[model samples]
Target chain A: MDHLVILPILLPMFAGALLLLSGRASEGFKRSLCLLATLLQLPLAIALMAQASGGLQVYAAGNWMPPFGIVLVVDHLAALLLLVTAVLAIAAVVYAVRGDDLLGANFHALFQFQLMGINGAFLTGDLFNLFVFFEILLIASYALLLHGTGSARIRSGLHYVLLNLFGSALFLIAIGTLYGVTGTLNLADLSQRVAQLPAPDAPLVGAAAMLLLVVFGLKAAVFPLYFWLPKAYAAATPPVAALFAIMTKVGIYSILRIYTQVFGDTAGPLADLANGWLWPAALLTLVLGTIGALAASTLNGLISYLLVVSVGTLLAGLALDSHDALVGSLYYLIHSTWVCGALFLFAGIISRCRGPRFVGRLVPGPALSRPTLLSGLFFLAAISVIGLPPLSGFVGKLLLLRAAETGVAAGWLYSLLLGSGLVSIIAFSRAGSTLFWRTDPAAAAGGPVDNVRLAAVLALLLCSPLLVVFAGPLLDYLTITVDQLLDPQEYARQVLSMQISTSGGGH
Target chain B: MELLYALTLGVLTMSGVYLLLRARTFPVVVGLTLISYAVNLFLFAMGRLHTGKPAVLGQVAEHADPLPQALVLTAIVIGFAMTAFALVLALRAQGELENDHVDGRGKR
Candidate 1:
């Protein structure tokens, strides 16, 4: 069990180091190592999920106890996210290894390091360690985002880096304030201590929460903080961009973790003062992100907007916060990651066949002479993203709306969610019409699709319907996970009691 | 001492925001650096200023909160890496595009 806790992070970190040290290694060798590492993670993540479902597991490093040492705790929620991350990572790695001529040995090394950071962020029980994991991931992403170094990529990558740096700064400030007040950085320890603080200290907590919210909001690409995302995402290569689809969700995951565990139900003086203020901000995010998606003209830009819609949905879910809504949010997150990643891969294939100039031009390409498997795949992924029935995405939205309707805030939030869903459907339809239906004369003259890229698109396309069929059991599992997260007393007790028992043995 | 540190933070943040809003890429890079420094100091200050207490086990007195210091150290290294990457990107953009506007689409 302890080995399961460490394997996800260690596997990637070790692979990354080996790849980096074996400088100038053959691209074939590096690709095999990357695939091997990612494939190995899939089973390990499954085992971690099974272990976490039984109860929370905590691993303290160097035999040091909590509050004095670093620990990695795996709750059900973390395990689910780790599993989703592994799936997306494996897909992205496979696609990169197969098609892209530019994806070299060093790229695989950076990819593995990025995985390490992401997994560590999800698994760690310490606040400082989370920050460390974030930095590791962000730095790796910075390099990967600029891997090809084109004019557009470089320009967008700079904005991406600067914006995240700002978010990182805010995160540091939040950590500082949290430490200043509580004198501890261990998350489980802080969760207990934060509940004990007096009324007068409420302002500090609110300030800290707001700061952290802003930081994560920026990362998550919520309204007012999301301007950099579309351009940055659009500028990167397809495989890199596909992996980045999961990056913003990491921010949402952090916010969910902190709010549920650390902040809990204690409104404090400041929360009461700011009563429901953040909800309006969240509403603005929902509307603004959807509108942005609606207006996007290019295939990549449109997908970027859809990513924004996913964030909007997650935020709306947070505002509603019922059990069903939380489950909806979790399900939506999983559905969106798969759909968005698949869409981007398909878009890459389309762009390759049509060339950059043909995109969004509404020009008809050559009619499909044979079985157009990629087009079918793109259509399925698009429908799933739009939350059409008989798809995994539909199940998530149905549950989300069901959950939202039962709340006191239902009157306004329900309408907003419904409106957002409609706009998303229309936006995705427009992208599909332009991409699959419209054809350009030049593209028509250009011959058949690249076999390898088309194959990658087909693989992802097959995944969407399968996800829809499995939604029932997956949702049940997620619901139980969310329930455990909502009441983490068992987790808190295990951590604290472990520390006490270990210290008793030492003395 | 706390007041001075707070003032430094205020100034850093203000300048960083101003530079961040600038149209050019170089100033934005500079602004990010200033902001990073302020953040590092801010995180370091969370341990509550005690001049004599090092973040190490000693024979005497109380120790500073080594956790925040450790966290800040990682932040600083990561910050440096990101900053260097940003600079390289800025250089690349200027080399390839013949312009230095932070946003690729030009002055908006």
Candidate 2:
């Protein structure tokens, strides 16, 4: 009932619409408006986290009842993600403004719209409404991806677009089937009702689940379905790619939400079917994504492949189904989003200096040597991403290992995860060695580093230690989040109770 | 009557899969559209179609399942939007790359 729950979505949407309407306004105004809107959202997101930490809150739109109306539900897990997403978004917008000199007035507008779509997707509880928000985000991404529309970008962006379109189509079909069988789109109500279906309806439900898996799998860049990710990511401008980093995680969040909350009990034949095949699929995804990362040479390509690896790790975590595994996966998810996003931004900075052809090679020499301070910061960030000790990345990996050990599938998955981590370390080291350590004679001729770009890099670099220090509380928060996820009846009751209270009062 | 719906599902699945497997982006787009149509129809079918009865409840008759129908309407709109975006992106790619390969990344 409170405004806090919906503002995270509404603020960006209103900002985006305003930016579009004021498209002819000065760039300063647009930038300030975007910054003000994003800055305003941070406090709102914090307030939501505080409210949700106590219990789940569901807001049914337009005063409509469930199983019929669209709902916006925020549990601890969703709230935590919303908070993380908001923080990353703020950093990204700042970086975009500082680093991307080529960005025009329309850039801010598209960026706002993209944020609106992302927040909307996370907040919505209705399946169809989820699709609506997804489209809003995807359309905005299409424009952002093709901002400059070079041949390479257009080629890669198209691949990203077509593949996602296929996924969206499948998503539609899945929603259709689920609706036909369950006769309801409300997630909270569906969670309770789907389990009560007759035996004959099992296949239909299974089909729907499988279709959904495919749709989300593509979005998450899962194995055999991740062919479009690496190049598309590599070709985009850094800020755009940084935003893209959040996109796949959003897909993962959806999968986790739907699989556990809406379809919690996989009993009887369908349960057996999901368990038998899904885990193996996860295994393949983990292995393939790791191999791809190891093989890639370019910085952008390397980070792109790592994204695939991270997706694999997440899938493996879900497949194992241990609380430890879930915690590890969640931890890894946060670490990867920040690390990968930072790296992409760094890659952009490097590319700006050495040109796009600078992959797997350093500048000819130390051209911008005045700010020894900036290089020091970049070094810390780079080491952190490579999972060196006393940083967030290392702690996340440690949790994953610990989680893997607690499960029966750990014997094999643990080894795979370990191997993947090693490969990732090596891949990152190789890229770092080429980009940061290598001293090319030609690079020395370039002028001093831009202060704005240096500041953005430093900001990200400073986050490394904070992650390590705060790991205890972060882990506790995730544990509570997982507990809420596992037992969603609490969520359902909260929503239903709220509805009864409001209806009684209104009448 | 339900058998007819099942047969249509088979046809839709076949065509959609066939189109999806094509190398060209346009065909894939077409295939996706067909699949979406089939999916919407199948979801509608799940409510168990009744002869001479609409979903609206009246004074004298039992209402068919309103939930699936309402859900289908939403799906249709989303499906159309997805298709439109995909088509525009595809056309843009074709213009930019001078090729129509659905997998636009150069050499995998």
Candidate 3:
């Protein structure tokens, strides 16, 4: 029970390593092992979530202790994200088994390695370790992005690679600057130290904080920094793109974690560090992303653009910084990830059914083999994404609108949110009518639908309504998570007051 | 001494940004490497500019902090791996597309 916190990180690490060493194994064997590892994470995440709600749970590496050795802190927020990631991993693995897993050597291995990095990033209590985990996941993603051989993919992959490499360079610079000023890499220690930064050193600390924001912003694909996302995501195969959906949220998670804990409203000299620019940029991001969606000629392009819209909305909530706004953001965050991932998978199905020449274009095509099922799934996902009533998205937007009503930017937020929803409505309606109504029934009838892939998409699509159904409990959990996030004094105390074995300190 | 370090960082960063704006892949890869070098050096300097003292405790009033060195070592290794991966990707793009331009064509 006490060791549950490390299992999320360690299980994937060991699984990934084992998969790497067993290169001669059959594909089926490797995949099942990956599935088992991912399945184990769901219950483990639940247990960690339960335990974390009691208090912060810290596991010091090598038993050396807090400020000196590495620590993994399982608070409610980390646990919630872990659970969400684990669910997505399961769906992606199941979908890949329908044949996308054969794209490259050891795809399962890299997937697990990616999970290891993501879970480590969420769980680690140290800043430098977060950088290491970012690189781990990123290198894995670079390889995954180019999983198949195509000129278009390699072209976009190059841009993605170079851009992220640049982001990483800035990340290192930020961490170095922060360490130089604070002399500690442990997050809990840094939180206390950052609040007490002397006047002479305050500017340096503020610079470090802002640079970190830029690095994370690049990851999250904020307004000016998001140019590399749409094309890169569109070029990847469907299952891989679905898995990549959660990757952006990692950036959002970090922003929420750092700002609320280390750079909160009470930050001594650097209070409201990035707020001046954040909401305005987020609003612009929302506008640009929706416009991009409307302008997108292909269905994948539209979905990717919608992803940008979701991030913009989430950031606006983050900018508000009110408890209600955060609650809405967390709820919206989960809903968007699930729905976005499902849309990517559905795009694959749509493209496969329509043939490669007319891949998910908003043009007339032959009717699908299972037109009803395909169209039904598409309608559900589209409705949810466009924030129509009775779906999780509507509930999420309602909460966010209510939260925004109390903010200074209420007028702007209301116009953009509603306006974006209207634009998506027109876009999705046009695409849907062209896709289902205009296609000739004879030409599109014979494409064989893979049941495994169908089941995987169905599972994630089902989660949208399930989210709405269980909104009451989920909001309860998110409220506690936000409360835990805002109240960092207790986190600092818990992390700092751990029993340390002073004699075994060998670094 | 600080001026020298800051100037070196600035020059490397400027050259990196310049190359990164190029339309070719190899130069961009080189630019990434140069930027990482600058970042690594900056991380090393975070421990402060210590000259002759051992990294461990010594008779001197202060020793070089070993943590940044460790951090920089990790960064170097990861950066090397990324560079190798990016180079392989560039070579493949060249082989398949018959071009080395970052976008594989004249325009994005």
A1-507, model 1: which lDDT tens digit per residue? 256798899999999999898877777888899889988988988999999877888887666788777889988888998988888888788788875625433788889999999999899998878888988898888888877656777778778887888888888888889888888778888877777777777678779878888887788888788888988888777888888888899988987887777776543343222215446766787788788888886778888888887888776786666678889989889888878988887777777666555643334554433325656676678778878887877887788778877545776677886788798888877766665666554444433576666666666656677777887788889889888877745667887677533545442
The regions of model 1 sitting more than 4 angstroms off are: A101-105, A266-278, A359-371, A406-408, A442-444, A450-452, A499-507, B104-108
DockQ metric, candidate 2: 0.56
Residue runs of model 3 more than 4 Å from their true location after superposition: A406-408, A440-446, A501-507, B58-61
Residues forming the 10-long window of minimal summed lDDT in candidate 1 chain A: A266-275
Writing each residue's lDDT as its tens digit, candidate 2 over A377-413 gives 5566656665668788778767877777754677777
Which ranges in model 2 have alpha carbons more than 4 Å from their true place? A99-105, A265-278, A356-378, A406-408, A442-444, A500-507, B1-9, B55-60, B104-108
The alpha-carbon deviation from the true structure for residue A44 of candidate 2, after best TM-score superposition, in angstroms, is 1.3
Candidate 2 CAPRI-style tier: medium
lDDT of each: 0.78, 0.75, 0.89
List the pairs of residues colliding in candidate 2. A364-A440, A364-A441, A364-A442, A364-A443, A365-A440, A365-A444
TM-score of 3: 0.97
Most accurate candidate by lDDT:
3
Kindly report the docking quality category of candidate 1.
medium
Q: Is candidate 1 or candidate 2 better by TM-score?
A: 1
Could you tell me how far off, in angstroms, the CA of residue A95 lies in candidate 1 after the best superposition?
Answer: 1.0
C-alpha TM-score for every candidate: 0.93, 0.91, 0.97
Q: Write the per-residue lDDT of candidate 3 for residues A154-236, one digit (tens) a residue.
A: 88898899889999999999999999999998999888898888999999988889899999998999989988899999888
